[model samples]
Target: RDLNALGGLAKLMPFTAIFTLIAALSIAGTPPFNGFMSKWMIYQSTFLSGNGLLVFFGVMALFISAATLASFIKFYTTAFGGEPTKLTQNVKEVSSSMLIAKGFLASLCLLLGLIPALILPLLLSPGKALANVDLSGLITT
Candidate 1:
């Protein structure tokens, strides 16, 4: 999809930054964001599985986080770096509406990261529907 949007992966550095920012916001489990729900599922599942191997998943999450930061740095160092090339010099700041949209999504991402519990009921709906199970009793020890 990014390729389709930017003509190819060669022109994808900017998209990569936005993508990394989104991932970072998500891992934090803030509020009003999908990332919160996703991390919540990871936390809930890891605890419920009651297996030591599940603990390793937490480490994996951290590794993913480091990788996200690295990717974003790559995007910044290249896409917005010093000495803009001919092609990049023509680029201008995105429109206000586009920036506002991005900011709104970014804000939601932060919200989800901050208060995941606020969305627990909505997040758990899928688990409820799947097996007709009541997960209210499951607690991480």
Candidate 2:
């Protein structure tokens, strides 16, 4: 849908707005979301590498992350906040199936963030085997 059409639709479609908000927050790397976990690991690894250039890039990454956060905040607020426009006057919540799918993915984002250890083995196994490195020790500490 066009950007103008989304104005005020959040009230008509609250659930979808909520889902979008969660996804946006996750993408922005807010804490307790999957994106934050991966970004945190990246920053940690970059800093630990002790390379001057990599450290500079890591700082750049932090600035980029902040920019992303601001952009998403503006997007969510503009699309979902304020009074309903003519185009959004009749908007309604989406079907249950769509909501179920979105809810499932959003919950996964939370689960992955809160307990990454559960999925680390599945994620690291192939890399571990290919590189002949012991990632178990790395993941635990």
Candidate 3:
């Protein structure tokens, strides 16, 4: 979905802000976003697995973050920002309605990011039914 919005694969470029956001969130162990908490569990599970090579996996996760940032910078500078050209001159700012929609979604993203507690309970209902574990009590929020 984000790929489609950013542009197709042919012209597609990475966005570091998005990747950094994912990495930071993943490392934080917060809930409701399905990022931080899951990665924390995975890190714990890997350590418990008793596989010494799991260290490499953890290292790779960090390395991938650097790569993600580099890719995002390349894409942002090359694809999005530049002096206007003929093809791009035709492009206009997205409509106010579209901006409003994006702004609402962005706020939702931030809200989920800042307060996972609100989302954790709502998600736990269905998640427990499927996973058969009481995750509701696990989240701080």
> Which candidate achieves the best TM-score against the true structure?
2
Order of models, best TM-score first:
2, 1, 3
Model 3: clashing residue pairs? 16-72, 29-36
Model 1 misplaced regions, further than 4 Å: 1-37, 40-44, 136-141
- TM-score for predicted model 1 compared with the true structure: 0.58
Worst 10 residues of 2 by lDDT: 132-141
Residue 56 shift from truth in candidate 2, angstroms: 1.5
Off by over 4 Å in 2: 139-141
Q: lDDT tens digits, residues 13-57, model 1?
A: 454446445645465443445664675567767755778898679
Model 3 Cα lDDT, one tens digit per residue, 1-141? 232234222222223334334444443443444455445445654555667798778766656655655765555544354454444445545566765665565556566656666566776689788988886654543
Looking at model 1, residue 119 earns an lDDT score of 61
Q: Backbone collision count in every prediction? A: 11, 0, 2
| Error in Å for residue 104 of model 3 | 1.0
Per-residue alpha-carbon lDDT of candidate 2 for residues 1-141, written as tens digits (9 for 90 to 100)? 577566876888888888888889889998898888778877876776789999888888888999999999989988999999887788889999999999998888888888888777887789788999866665532
What is the total number of backbone clashes in candidate 3? 2
